[model samples]
Each structure stands twice: as structure tokens, then as C-alpha cells.
Target: MTAEEYQEDILDHMEHMEAETMPDVNSIDIQTEIQWFMRPYLLDFLVEAHAAFQLLPETLFLAVNLLDRYCSRRVVYKRHYQLVGCAALLIAAKYGDRKERVPTVRELKSMCCSLYDDEMFTQMEWHVLQTLNWVIGHPTVDSFLQIALSEVTYDAEVEHMAWYISEIALFHKEFVSVRPSVLARSALALARCVLSRSQARQSEWAGTYDPVVVLNLSNHLYQPSQVLSRKYASMHLSAVSTTVEEFLQRQAQIARRNITPPTPPALENQKPDADGYLTPSTPQKSHYDAVMQHGCLTPPITPDNEFGASNFAKNVLPRLYPVTPTSAPQEAPQQQPQQYSYQPYLQPRLAQ
Candidate 1:
């Protein structure tokens, strides 16, 4: 196909896949058998696994999408959560990666410390495929992102930071409700915001943008994502957090000055407190409490292949989803820019 025709075809495919794969947020209830907090923990392990397996970004996104779709339709026990994740990963790899790169049944079992044997994983993989109706090739956020990024002129650092923010969004429940195209746009806008402030002088492409337009478009597209907001506020993980804080400060300033900013549909029910920050609604189980309650607060024991069957019950199951401590020292905020510039891009054309 011609280049223009190829782009149009990709956009058409993205719309179709997004419609098929989008999760129904309203249908998800933390009070059900699976808790809300468990998602983040599960996503954390998926991230680690993706890194360990050196899987593609598209693979990670597809795997998470599959897991969420399955969890939304079924009531999965916490015990089977890891199995579901591994199965999702295996499925995603088969579709998105080379055969040699996909982890074997034994490798996956070893990764879970043999709490589940190869047969169990095999069974679970079939179950996931059945639950998902064999829909393994649907488009993901990364798929939309690749197309969106192609429309913009960005440096490698900007691309990487945008990717980091997008991956972080995968861990947030609120983001699950967002469309893939909107998510990609918001991530790119945030990345540009960070890049604008950090640079001593703006690049040529940066000069062609207007910050107000970018922020407005992003705000209109994405609701206040608490998990994403808090994550970006942390200075330890990325310098982008500092930029986000400064960007928010400027937004608050504009609002105080009586400039009407476009509000997103998701944030209509969310009112900002006196500090102009919106706190997320309480989850059924807080992340920390869930970690403690599930014995996920400590590092997991490495797999011991030589352990006897008698020791299996004590040493294996609990280690499947171990959690690391959460801590990030606060840093002084950066100075706000006198003027910001951002240019909004067009959304992908929808199919008729």
C-alpha cells in the first residue's frame, strides 16, 4: 500500500481494535472476589516480567489488556492471579514476539516458584484464550502511541519519557476507562511539558507549540488520573514529575486568575480541594494495606527447585506476588516558565 494509504489503514485498524478491547470501567467492582488494589500489584509484576523477558512494549500493553478483560468478565481468586498474568504474557508473546522469545511453561512455573506446575499453566493459558475468545491481536495503547508519535517531531529523550509515563498509566485503574488514543495524546502532552521546562532553550519544533492549547486538550481528554498524577509527582523515578508539578501549579494559577480551562467529562464529579488538588476516591483496599494483608510487603523468595513437596506449602505460594516498600523523598519544586507553548495534534480518523 502507499504510505498515506498505509497510515489510513493503520488508523482504521486502531479504531476497530480499541472498540473490541476497551474495558468497561463501570462494570468493574473491587468488592467482587478480586480487590481493586490487586491490579497495581499485578501490573507491577507484569512490568517486572516484561523487563525480565525483554518483551516488546506492544507485548506488555497487550498482555495487560488481556488480563484486565479476563478479570472484568470473571471472578478470579487471588491465587490464580499470577497464573492469569503469566498466561496473558504467553499469549501476548505468541502474537507479538518471535517464538524463541516466548517463555516456556517450565520457565513460567519456575518464575512463580513452582506454586503452579507446567500442566496448570497450560490449562490456565487455554482458559485465558477461551475467556478472551481468542482475541489476542487487538490493538493496544502502544499501537495507538506508535502512530501518534509518528505524527509529531520528537527527540529520543521525549519519546522515552512519554513511554515511561504511558507505562505508568497502565497501573492506574482510572486510565483503564480511557481510550487508547486519548491516553497516547495525554502522555505525549505531558512529555512535551517536561521537555519544555527542562531545556535551557526550546527546540525549533517546541517553538511552534502553545502550552495552553496542549494542556487544555489533555485536560479535556483525560480526567484527573490520581495514580498517574501522584506517580509523576515523584522526583526519584523521573524528572518529568517535577515538570508535571510545575505545570499543575501554572494551571492552578490560571484558574485562580479566572481563566476558564476546558474540563474533562471524567473530572466533572471531582472537585478540587482548597489546595486545588483532587484526591482520588477511596479504594476498597488501599495499596499498602492490601500488600500487608496479602504478605506482599517483603521481597519474594527466589525459586528453589530442590525444595521438597512438604516445604512447598510454606515457602512457595506466598512468594508469588511479593511487594517492595514504597518510599520517595520529596524535592523542592522547580520554577514555573513565564510562557509555555504546545500545539495540539489531530486525533486518528474514525471508521464510518
Candidate 2:
């Protein structure tokens, strides 16, 4: 979503919360109001960048979740939103991309339209790292949905439809403003509905947990009502999904309307190739040269066994379904717990 759309969505949500609960709108604003309103702005800013880069949807989704979960638990004052947003995106880049290079603080600032200075962005990044206790892994919507979908052996058509609906659901800011659990359930329901229609005659659909039940559960998360799954499915399922050909058509429309096409970073002086891979005027030195000559980087790891190959393939292949990596990097070894360090700048304010 664009920044304007995000701002309008949040304002509508605040208004709704105001009317329902009749909270004092003037005193500190809404009940959940933060003195630091910049956090949501930063989040919307990051979302626009991520969407522009054609980054993993899971990357944007998980990053936002981490930011929300962290902020919901702590208090951050002025200029802190930048820190949380950057840290969340960094964590997301790591988890979502096996070979994802760590973008420098400068690069992050550029991503945010240069709205933040390097020093301010760095401090905020540090604060987020500290707030998260420097741990990045968390259970995520992508994993959850993937796991749920894998339970049934649906056809290619079903798979395509399910993915289409899931993507469309994200564009609805009303859905995004709701609780994470509600959003998850809604995505699942949409996915299930698509799959069911594609395989209406199959016994697989019959044996699976009722799609209506899943959807009704989702609706209840938003408001109390027994929403009819068929009615919901009939109204939205076709509008949201289709076979592979139709899905691409929808993606093109989304790119034109709601999302910007993938573009090269600000540092890349030249336009990227057709596939959106950045190529500088002069190619950079290879990893081995950098490592051996300058002692700048680490060497690649060799897989030890077939079991390792199986594990890596299983973990990596499924995530590739909707988001394509810009460049393949050797998977970084998971960081050891002993080596974890939170940045000093993000340390919580000590009591006087």
C-alpha cells in the first residue's frame, strides 16, 4: 500500500475504535496511541520499499509483525520508529533470504526515501536490535500458511487460486489493520476457498476440515457473526483468483495500481536488467579475492551429507513459490546463541 493509503487506513481504524469504545479522543488520542506516531509512518515507508523491490511478501509481513510485537510490548519516544522499522526489516531479510546480504545503514536510509539521517537511522536500528534482544527467528504467517496448505494434496490449479487470493487479501488495508491472528485466519480461509472450488469433486475437499468452519472462525476474529462460507466464497473467490494465466494478469494489475514495479537501489547508477538484477558499471571483485586480499569476507560452506541436502532443499524450495531471490547467496550458517549481541544504542532507558 502507498503511504497515503496507509495513513488513511490507520485514521479510519482510529475513528472506528473511537466510535465503538467512545474513548477520550483528545487525551493522548486513541487508547493505544503512541507519543511516537512516526513508527507507523516508518512501517508504511518500509512496506512501500519492500513492495517496490519485489522482496518476499513474507519479508514485509514478518517484518511488520516483529515491529508491532516489539512496540506493543515497550515504550519508544521520538525518532525511535526508524530504529524498530530498520531492525525488523533486517531480521526479515535474514530469515526470508538464505543468501541475503546485510544492507548497510546507509542503504536502509536510502530505502526510506532518505527521510532519515545515517546517525538517526543507526541509533534507531540499534534500539530495535536491543528491543528484540537480537533474536530474529519467529513463527511467521508464510510458514503457517505453507504448513496448512501442505496438509492437502491439491492440484496445480488449486494451488494457483489459493496463492492469488492470499495476495489479494494483503492489499485490503482493512485486513492489515486487524489483529495478526485475524489476518492469518482470513488468508487461510481465502486459500481454502480457492482450493475447494478448484477441487470441488475431489474427496480431498470432503475429508479436509470444513472451509466454512475455518472462514467462520476468521470472521469471528473480526466481529461476532456466523458468516456463510459459500456466500463469501461466491462473492470473492472468483474475483480474487484463477489459473496461472489469470493470476499473472492480476499481478500486472496490482503492479500498475497498488505496487510499484521492482527497481534498482539508489546506489545503482544504471537501470537494472529485464529481470531486475542490479549491474554496476564496473563489476565488483569476487568473494575469494575480497576475502584473501583484504580479509573482508568469509568463504562458502560445503554440504557434508545427503541429509543436509534434503534439509536445505525442503527449507528453501517452498519459500520460492511466490518471491524470487534477486541473487543467490550461499546460505549463512545459523548464528550461535553465544555470539548474539544487542547494539548499545538500543538499550532501554535506565530509571533515574
Candidate 3:
């Protein structure tokens, strides 16, 4: 299929997946013991974990998917939340990473501060798989992003910027309810808006695409992802927030001139072939392969000087497990070694 056709096919599949897996907003109450506030922290830790382990982007997405789906079905205690999150990541690694890259039970246990023993983690891993019905192939925002971005200009920087924005979106609870395709498109549109604003001073026609339309679609499709918005505002990783502010200001200036905003292109519906699949064209396949290999079209673009697993473990891990200084170092010893006396790792759950 042509790039456009491939994009359309991916969009169709995303729509179906969204319908099949969308979480029910009404059923989710974050105000109880499980404060909605804790979710962002958990996600932040997961992102750090993803970077720390140098796992594939697909693995991170799958891990997050499992975390959300399992949480939706079960009433997880706040204490057990981190354990569940770690278990999900472990399961995802086994599914998406090569055997050599997958972390061992001991490694994951150490990462979780050894709060839960190996048996606890193993039980939670089995619980997640059972809760998710052993399905781990959901189409993530990253996948849709690759397809959507290929249709637009192929600027490596812009692609990385959109990816950064999308990854930020994953940290917000509101976005969990949004469709992956919509999130990917909105991120791309925002990236384009940012790029256009930067060149507006030199070129009269720099702001070709309409930011109002893109922002409006995003607002209508998903609840306000304030965490994501605030993160962009605070981080120096990119000028996305400033660009967005400038875009709005420019839009207002253009509106005063009575310039009609261009109508955004409607998403086209493309039928699948007799084989029930849309074979991507050479260029499309190449772009897809690049994303699979490199996670994005470009190399890592995080602004932090040392953005890796070690940095994450050293900096972010402490925040999650605050260290209290004791008079004697021996007074507060590290986690006790596991006895492994609990039931077998894969004990079957009792039927309801």
C-alpha cells in the first residue's frame, strides 16, 4: 500500500482496537485509597524503568497496557501498585524483548526495593496475564505515530519532538481513555504547529496547518491531560509549550485579518485486500522498519545529560523509596534476603 493507504489501514485497525479495549471512564475512581495522583508517579517510574533497562518502546507500551487493564479489573492496594507495575514490565519484556535482554527475577526484585519477594512478583505476573486474557499485542500510540508521521514531512527532529510529546501523554491518567490513533495524530499536529511557529518570522506562509482545528479535535476526543500539559510547560526538553502559546497568539492575529482557517483533511477509509491485510509499500515498510529498530526515526533526544537506566535508578528511585537517615547505618539495614517459602510461583487462582 501507498504511505497514505498504509496510514489509513493502521487507523482502521486502531479504531477497532480502541473499541475493543477502551477503559470505562465511569468505572474508574481515583479518589478512594488508590489516589489518582499516584498514577503519574507510577508511570514516571515505569518510563524510568523503560529507559533504565533500555527496553523497546513496544515493551513499555505493552507493560503500561497490562498495568491499566489489570488495575481496571482488580482492586489493587496502593502498597501493591508498584509490585504490579514491575510485574507488568517483566511480563512485557518476556513478550517483546530477546531472551538475553529480558531481566531476571532477581533483577526486577532488586529494582522494586525488594518490598515484594520473588513469589509475590511471580503471582502478580500470573495475575496480570490472566486478567488480560494472555493478550499483549494491542496497537500502541507509538505504532500509530509511525504510520501517521510517514504521511507528513519526514523531519527527524519533528518526529522526535512528537514522540517526546506522546511519551509525556502516557504519564497522564486522562489519556489512558483516549484512542491511540487520536493521541498519535494530536501529538503530530502539535509537533507541526511547533515547527511552523519557529519559521513564521522568516516565512509569511509558515503556519500552513491550523492549530485551532488540531487543538479542538484533541479536546473533543480526550479529557484535558493536564499532567502532560504541565510537564511540557515545565520541561526544557523542547519549546513545545512556547510554540503552542505562540501558535495561539498568531491564530488570533490571523483571525483579526478575516483569514479563513483551512479545513482539515478528513480521514479516509481504505478497504483491506483479499488476504485481509494491507501490504505496505517499500517506503512505508522502510519507515516502519526504522521505527521498529530505533524506537523512533531518530536517536534518543532527551535533553538530560545522562538519560539512562542508571541515572533513573539513582535519581528517581530514591523519590519512590525515600531514604531516612538513621544514627547508625546498621539500624536501617537493606532489604532482607528472600526465603522463597511461599507457594509455587504459578499457583492457579481459585475460581470465583
TM-score of each: 0.58, 0.42, 0.56
What's the number of clashes in each of the models?
A: 5, 2, 1
**Per-residue accuracy of model 3 over 1-352 as CA lDDT, tens digit each:** 5665565566677679766876655445742457677877787777767766878777877788778887777887889989988998999899878888887779888877877898998898888888878876778777766765554456665665666666766666666777776676667777765576232222221233345435644343233244444444544445455545576667678877787666799767644443333444545322122232323232232444344566776674323222565675566668988886676678779999
On lDDT, the leading prediction is 1
Worst 10-residue lDDT window for candidate 2 reads 223-232
Over all chains combined, what TM-score does candidate 2 have?
Answer: 0.42
Give a tens-digit lDDT track for model 1, residues 28-136.
6743666777887777677767767877888988898888888877778878988999999999999989777898888888888899988889898999889878877
Query: Model 1: number of clashes?
Result: 5
Worst 10 residues of 1 by lDDT: 284-293
Per-residue lDDT tens digits of candidate 2, residues 57-173? Answer: 578666766666566556644455666678678777767764555456777777767777888765766666676666555544454445445545744444434434443333333
* Residue 144 in candidate 1, Cα distance off native in Å: 1.4
Among the numbered candidates, top TM-score falls to 1
User: Candidate 3, after superposition: displacement of residue 130 in Å?
Assistant: 0.6
Q: What is the C-alpha RMSD of each candidate to the true structure, in Å?
A: 41.3, 40.1, 42.5
Root mean square deviation (Cα) for candidate 2 = 40.1
Between prediction 2 and prediction 3, which has the larger TM-score? 3
